[model samples]
Target: MPTKQEILDLHFMDARYKLIDLAAFLDRVDRHSGEGDFRFDALKAALPLLLSEQQGRAKAVLDALSDPSIEPIEKATTQGASGAPRPAGVPL
Candidate 1:
């Protein structure tokens, strides 16, 4: 088993762009949202695609962020419509 710091550094510290790549995404979300509701909502939204194969890791990361001691603030931005909705600038 990897040490916690190793797991964290490998999964979160060097991640880029995508939330699934980062272990801390949930923690950040929890710290920024002021509620677990939003964090779990975001996780449920993302899980089908990003965490399907790594559900345990995803759950662990999310659970860690659920601590009441964490703060929450609204995220500065959100992704455009998911599924078939293409982001701006990409030809449909």
Candidate 2:
């Protein structure tokens, strides 16, 4: 099984690759299209905001991990229809 750090490293690399791929695709669209194209303009405007939000979320996760005082997430529990407690996992 991969360690936590290994999983984080892989996730970071994947994020970088995805950003690069998005930029390349945007560049291709910009090159082949008119300067005033709405699609390109909208994407260009949104990219920075998207990147900033992603960075903020990543930083928050790292901060939470590194803070020793922060509690780990407990195994989620929920009451089933029969009124019994059941383990649950939240999807990200």
TM-score to true structure, per model: 0.23, 0.40
Q: Point out where model 2 deviates above 4 Å.
A: 1-7, 33-36, 51-92
Candidate 1's residue-wise lDDT over 1-92, tens digit each? Answer: 99988887887744554645455766676578455544355455555554456557755555444433344435625554322222235342
Quote the lDDT for 53 in model 1.
67
Worst 10 residues of 2 by lDDT: 83-92
RMSD (Cα, Å) of candidate 1? 14.5
Q: Give, for candidate 1, the lowest lDDT window spanning 10 residues.
A: 81-90
Candidate 1's C-alpha runs over 4 A off are 1-21, 33-43, 51-92
Q: Model 2 has how many clashing residue pairs?
A: 0
lDDT of each: 0.51, 0.52
- Superposed by TM-score, candidate 2 places the C-alpha of residue 65 at a distance from the truth, in angstroms, of 31
